[model samples]
Target: MTTMTFTRKDPPQWLLDFWKEIDDKTFGKGFDCFAHDAVCNLGVADWHGRDAIRENLRQFIDRGFTAHHDVVEYWDGGSLKVFHGKVRMTFDDPALPVVRPAMAHFFYMDEKDPAKVRRWLGSVGPIEF
Candidate 1:
């Protein structure tokens, strides 16, 4: 893992709830997490706005990927604020020798306030390089 240091800032209730919905396999219903014009750069692809974000996430789930966050760490500073976590992704594919994990990093900005995420630069990767 790369050495990183970020100020501790817990995610808001609404954001947490959105993740809960995702964990429950109900993603499209959580578009409220993203701002109206938020841009998301998912590792495999990039999307803009709530609709595109929903579509991207749906594709991810359909690829047999499910993420579970083990720990959430936050950081904030002058012009930098983010929350990251190390998570494991379970797959339904029998061909995979073992379940893989990934580091989920979110580079978020304050829209009108910290409660809303303005932009998202997210990355998800398989454990094996």
Candidate 2:
């Protein structure tokens, strides 16, 4: 697993662990970080609730896609936490070539439950291989 470096303030341990799971190629373990009713918005698809999100994430992870997020900036304004970073992935499949996204941007807007990420909205722009 590659160690990811962040440019700003340190995120909570759980969040860090969550991301670490991905870098470790253990996306299933990563789902433990989300709330049961959380919502995840990928650029091309939106997965609602943890079950759907977990299953969808499993598909790519199972396919051997390694996900890494390198944070360039982060804003934790008490309730709203925003993330902007460079995301890179290794896609072992021939159909979806590996890509280096310009930056991974996301806004975790719901803070009703501090320990769990409730709502996530983000998109990554990729450079074609």
Best by lDDT: 2
Task: lDDT for model 2, please.
Answer: 0.68
Cα error, candidate 2, residue 69 (Å): 2.4
TM-score, per-candidate, Cα-based? 0.73, 0.72
Give the runs in model 2 whose Cα sits over 4 Å from its true position. Answer: 1-8, 93-98, 109-111, 127-129
- For every candidate in turn, the CA RMSD to the true structure comes to 4.6, 7.2
For candidate 1, which ten residues in a row score worst on lDDT?
96-105
Name every residue pair that clashes in candidate 1. Answer: 7-75
Report the lDDT tens digits of candidate 2 across residue range 1-129: 844343456665666676676677665666666788888887777889878886776675676678776767676655456677776787778698767676554545456767677877777775335
Q: lDDT of each model, Cα atoms only?
A: 0.64, 0.68
TM-score of 1: 0.73
